[model samples]
Target: MKRVFIEHIESYLPDERICNEQVEQRIRAGGFDIQAGLLEKMIGSEIRYYARNDEQVSDMAVSAAQKLLHHYPDRKIDLLIFAAASGDLIEPATVNIVQQKLGLTCPGFDLKNACNSVTNAIEIASALLLNNSYKNILIVSGEKTSDSIKYTNIEKETIKDHFAAYSFGDAGVALLLTTTTEDKGLFYQRHQTFGEHWNLCRIEGGGSMFPNDASKLVFSGDTFGLKNVIYEIAPPFVKDCIQEAGLTVNDIDLICTHQVSKDTYRMVAETLSYDVNKIMQTFHLYGNTAATSVPIAYQQSLLDGRLQKGNIVMLLGMAAGINISVQLMKV
Candidate 1:
């Protein structure tokens, strides 16, 4: 099996910035009794971006891809994978639209695993590259969660449970994975799903189970869009993933946990007895970008000099499928 190396990576954040101060004011103006500094203390996101109303999910994805494509003008994309919970349409795969926008002739498709979509694509791309099926694979994700936000109906008591929903913002990320002769790319990857907890967090109205229609329509907060209930179930998976990769918490140089919230990842680190400083965070600045969070953080680490070549990095992603996935990579 050939190794897969990430040749290039980039992210696209819309110019629209929404600061915590604005969100707090809006929530307060909505006639809800809220304590001061509670939101930032809860999620730790001071600012995040939202795509323009005219921008579709594919548009953000194409913008992100162009950055990497511009960097490597001659690189040919053999496979294009669009991984995100937010898609442009329900019929045709969103990847087709992205492929058309980029003028790529490669075969393309979509992979949906809630927030774990990108990591899942990486695992699949690695296998394809190892089997000599494709030389290079491009994974693109555009998450426009702002479209689903429900701002009208709110009860003061239940709103606290839905605070995580407000933490989500819009962003896109692109990753180019090419075949490498060296054996130092992905060392270990593991994914576990708890179907019983699937109802903990989800968009109930968009799929076949609920159907997208006016009569059955539901708002993001009304459904379980951002409600998290896997706090106790997640720690065991994190420990197992490290052990499965033949590594311990101390062996990892950088750990990029999903940018869900400051409290969420902080609890994860404390639960695993891992060093809090080892975790690279973007939730404080960009909020939760869904599938793009890990890649966005990974790219930021590269720019900030926290992640480097040959560094052992661990990526932890948990999503609405009640899914927990971890990837141990040698960058």
Candidate 2:
């Protein structure tokens, strides 16, 4: 069977930078009880980017895909997958928009399971590559989480649900994968979704259950975002992923877990008994970029020399659908 390898990866960020201090001041000056420097300590991100009003998820995705194409000019991508926690529109899947924007004639579609979208896309793409379904696959994700936030009446759930909202940031990520007969590729990949906790984190509105209606909208209170239970429920699955990969915690050279927050990842590290230093993270600089978190951190790690060729790396993630996925790759 042919193996799949990540030929190149790239990420794009908006120019607008919002730091913890800026967000805190903005929230406090509006007569909220938000404390000073609390977000930085609680979530662990110093700064994050906010997309411009005109920019949507597909726009950022096109930018990232363009960069990936430029980097690997010779390769031909036969399949395009746009995975995101948030989509651009309600109908006509967002991947269609991305495919047209990228000017790709190949087949395209979307895979969404909240934050686990990209990880699952990789799993699907790898299977296709190994089975001779497609020669080259392109996966891209763009998240505009700042657009989903509701900042009013936040004091009601101040220390509870509202706090999780402040940690969300925006970003776009692209990855190129192709068949490689060499021994280095995906050795083991595993995924499982625990729907019992599906309601733990979600956007209840703007869907079939609660269609978007201005008359029925309520913004001040939990207008649909993550809850406090995600951090509590997601850690136990890390060990299952490790065991599935046929490796112990120590065997993996670097682990690129989901970028939820500094505190969340630290708790995950402690629960799994893995070294905190070995966990690659980009949340401090980018906060939680939804499905783009793991890929962005992976790209940063490759650039910073923390991850190198022939290293065993694991990508573990948990998303808003209360889903968790772990994939182990030999780079």
Candidate 3:
């Protein structure tokens, strides 16, 4: 079987830089009194970007994909997959919009499972590449989480159910995967979803459940409840991923874990007893960018010299559907 490897990865941030204080001010502007510095103090995130009013998720995806194509001009994409926790529209799938915007003629579609969308895309793309279905696969995600922020109805007593939205930061990420001759690629990939906890974090609208309920469109979540479930399942799975790969935590060169807040990010480091330095830190700068967090970590790790060719890299994802996925690969 042919192996799949990530050829290149890139991330794009929106132009507007919004900090914690600004988030609070926006909420206050909506006729709600909110305190400054509380968001940063609670979430441990200082800054995040917001896409312009005119910019759609497709536009941001195109920006990241264009940068990727610019760096590798000779490559041809055989498949395009747009994975996102949030997308441009309600119907006709977002991937079509992305493909048309990028002027790509290849087959395209979307795969969504909250923040695990990109990770799921990678799993499907890997299978396609290994089975000789596609030579080059481009997986992209653009999350305009600012669109889901509930600036009003933020009751202080029930804040846990709505607090994750405050950390909503917009970002775009693109990843390229292709068949490689090298034996090093995916070693072990595992995924599990606890449907029982689906309500722990979710948006109540945009589906058959509430097709026309415009008021239910904003994000609703129980960050503490979600984190508690992660604390129970995620750590053990990380250990299992390492063991299944015939390695130990010390053997992995880099572990890129998706984190929503500073506290959840630290839990990974603390639970696994792994070096905090080995994991990429993006929460402080980008917050939880939905599905883009892991790929953003991948690109940043490469830029910071923590990742190199032939290194064992692990991608750990924790998403809202209470989904958790771990992929061990060599790059």
Candidate 4:
């Protein structure tokens, strides 16, 4: 089988930067009484990026994809897979918009698995490469939570839940998965789904299941409803994925888990007895960028000199449908 490697990766944040202190102040002004370290403890984030009101998820994804293409201008991309939850519009698929904007002629489509979209895209792209169907595949994942965020009546839920209303930042990320004799490439990947938990963390009004009406958006107290589904199903999914990779928790050099919350991260780390330091967190700063979290963190790790070549890295993500996916890669 041919090897699938990440040729390049890039991420884009809104021009606005929201620091932890600012978030604390915002929540406190709203009478939430959240401490400064509270968010740090919950999501291991110091600051997060947010998109502007006019910016759409597709805009961010396109910007990041353009950056990646600029960096590696010589490569010929044959396929583009856009994995995202909060796209620009309801119809026409975000990938179509991205394809039009970037002028990318390669075959492209959108993949939706909630937060696990990117992970699923990676698995599919790898299979395509191995089958000689495509040589280079560009995967873009992003989320603009701020666009749909509702800042009122947040006190109805626990701090963890309410914090997400404010804490979840926005970001876009792009990755180039190619079939080459590159030294760094994916080793294995696994995906699983539990559709029973689909309605747990979802936007009840937007999709075909619940068609968004004026009342759904206007009367709805919360936009992305609840985090209970994620809290319930993610831990076991993480463990299963790790175990299926044929490696113990300790074998992972660095875990690039999805950016949900500090509680979620700690629970997974403790369950596997893995060191907290082994996990790279961006939620505190970037909140949950849905499909973009892991890839964004992976890019940051490379920029910061933390993720070096030859290291064994694991990309894990859990999204709606209570879906779970893990991709083990040798960098």
Candidate 2's TM-score: 0.91
lDDT of 4 by residue, 129-162 (tens): 9998998899997688765554444463545433
Considering TM-score, which of the candidate structures 1 and 2 is the better prediction for this target? 1
- Better candidate number, 2 or 4, judged by lDDT: 2
Better of 2 and 3 by lDDT: 3
What RMSD value applies to candidate 3?
1.3
**lDDT per model, in order?**
0.82, 0.79, 0.87, 0.76
- Top candidate, metric TM-score: 3
Q: Give the TM-score of candidate 3.
A: 0.97
Local error of candidate 3 at residue 167 (angstroms): 1.0
Per-residue error for 291 in candidate 2, Å, reads 0.4
Writing each residue's lDDT as its tens digit, candidate 2 over 187-222 gives 778776667666556566776767866422221223
Best by lDDT: 3
Off-target runs (Cα >4 Å) in candidate 4 are 20-45, 153-163, 214-237
> Which tens-of-lDDT digit does each residue in 148-214 have in candidate 1?
6545456776775456677878999999998766756787888888887666565667678777564
User: For residues 1-331, what per-residue lDDT tens digits would candidate 3 score against the true structure?
Assistant: 4578888898899999988888889889877787777887788856899999999999988899999999888778999999998788877889999999998999999999889999999999999988889999999999998888888776778666778888878999999998777777776788998788988888888888998998789888777878888899888987987888789899988889897888765788899998888888888888779999999988888898887778999899988877889998887
